[model samples]
Target: MLVRTFGWSFAITVAGLAFAGVLWGWQGLAVVAILSVLEISLSFDNAVINAGILRKLNAFWQKIFLTVGVLIAVFGMRLVFPVVIVAITAKIGPIEAVKVAVNDPDRYQHLVTSAHPAIAAFGGVFLLMIFLDFLFEDRDLHWLAWLERPLAKVGKLDTLSVIVALVALLVTATTVATSVPLQGGGTADKSATVLLAGVAGLVTYLVVGGVSGFFEGRLEEDGDEAAADADGAEETAPARRGGASALGLAGKAAFFMFLYLEVIDASFSFDGVIGAFAITNDIFMMALGLGIGAMYIRSLTVFLVRKGTLDDYVYLEHGAHYAIGALAVILLVTIKHEVNEVVTGLVGVVLILASFLSSVVRNRRLGEGSEQLEEQAEIPSGV
Candidate 1:
């Protein structure tokens, strides 16, 4: 399973490195290597979250994710995304943006960096909503009871996550600590633009999530009926899942899951596009490095889904969501403050590791308790 999951990933890695080596020889290769490491490190939590979603997708969608999805990750988000951003922000044609990126990478980097405030606002709010939505749900299993329980209570309010995200976006725009002057306008113009982009992100999340929920409801009703016919018994698990659930494979749920995965990738890419500047200003190199890293992350997601890693480490999802919340804050804060990519990446890594450790301890306790219960049962309760 591991080999099957990561086989193409290894191939992509080699191809990415070779692409870099051809572009700038050994120097480019080294930069791609470093960027790849940075991307994988920062995105490990993203992979975990993705695995939770991906396992719900069917075999066809799973194959689409590994194939078409990776192409989008590699070329779409890494290469074209920055150029598109620059083109929009700088009010230049796409051709001009591409030319500038290829011929004058430093200037391209400047344009991309200058647009970071808006980018951060969009990605930050989107990610924060994801984390908040997960926490706000009334789930039996609580990882951070002190906080999540209260959040769940508050979540009883309709569209609370959307409200909070809007408030956060407003606060971010207003309290950006020394307004950023626009290209040909005042700080107010830039702030308004940033707020609009942030709102766009919020809207995108709602539409996508709503679409997912719609399809989920449809599939769920069908699954419940199927389960009922099979045994005339209550659906033991969520109706959203299937028999291949142990494999994390979803039937029709794959479509929505794939859409969600792409949105999630776009959210992750905001930081990647920004962080690429710290390493190399070359757009092609950034794509090669970050794109390859994305492939690996996707591979990891598949591996985790296939191997039942999430089932084994139940609390891992909580940790990943928490890391996402932290990242959202970091992105919002970055509007005025320059944050280190290492710091950003390390925050996620620590949260995930901590959760993994907690899961390990919980697993051990559960195992021991089960053993004790079995022993007592064997001895006969009345005696």
Candidate 2:
């Protein structure tokens, strides 16, 4: 399973290294290697969260995610999107941005870093919404029952997640974003930019989530109607719904879900892109390295879904979300203070590992209890 899933990742790694070596020698190769490791470590939780969403789509859409989705991830997000950001932030054309990235890498890096206040605000708010929504949701299982149970109860209030996220954005903007130092060595007031970016992020989440949810609800309604028809009820609407309408609804749901996943990936990549400058200012090398890591992450998502890993380890999703919450806070904090990528990566890795270990222990306990009950039942019958 490992080979089958990671074969392309390995292949890409080698090719990317070869390309980097040809262009910029051993130093380029080393930087790409470091960036790849950085991306994977930081995004392990993202793979878990993605698996939770990807499993809902059928086989065809899953294929689309692996194929078309990766292109959007690698080229669109890693390459073009960064260029676009630089263009807008630097007030240059796309062509000029590319030239700047190639010829004046230090300047390009400066431009990208200059835009970090807004980027952090947007990504932070979007990720915070994801974490908050998951935290407030009522689930059949809870990893942190003491905390989650209370949050779930409070979540019954409409738009609670939105309200909380907005408040967080406002506070962070007023405090942290306002204190971020400018290139000229004085603090820059970025409160308005942060607020605007944060609102854009929040609205994007709502619109994408709403569209996906609407289609998913439609699919569920169709399913319930089909089940009723199977149970010998009048097959009035379902009989008409199955052929084309059902397929259309499924397609729509998958498409929107795919969009949601891409946006999530983009949010996860924001810091990685900005942080890449610390290692290498060459944008193409950054793309090659991060792109390789992204392919592996996508493959990991596929492996989790196919192996039913989430089902086996129930708390994995909860841990991923908690890690996301941590990341959101980190992004907001970084608006005023510098954070090491190592710290970001380690926090996620630790959360995921802790949850995995907890799941194993829980499974062992459940097995032991079942065995005890079986032995007691047999003894009582004999006695």
| Candidate 1 regions with alpha-carbon error over 4 angstroms | 181-189, 229-253, 380-383
Q: Please provide, for model 1 over 23-69, each residue's C-alpha lDDT reduced to its tens digit, 9 standing for 90 to 100.
A: 78999999999999989988999999999988877667878998999
TM-score of each: 0.90, 0.97
Candidate 2 at 137: error in angstroms? 1.0
Per-residue C-alpha lDDT of model 2 across residues 317-381, encoded as one tens digit per residue: 98999999999999989888999999999999999999999899989999999999998888855
- Among these predictions, the greatest TM-score belongs to 2
- Candidate 2 residue pairs that clash: none
Candidate 1 total steric clashes:
3
**What do the candidate models score in CA lDDT, each in turn?**
0.85, 0.91
Model 1, residue 155: C-alpha shift (Å): 1.3
In candidate 2, stretches whose alpha carbon ends up further than 4 angstroms from where it belongs are 233-240, 380-382
At residue 244, candidate 1 shows an lDDT of 48
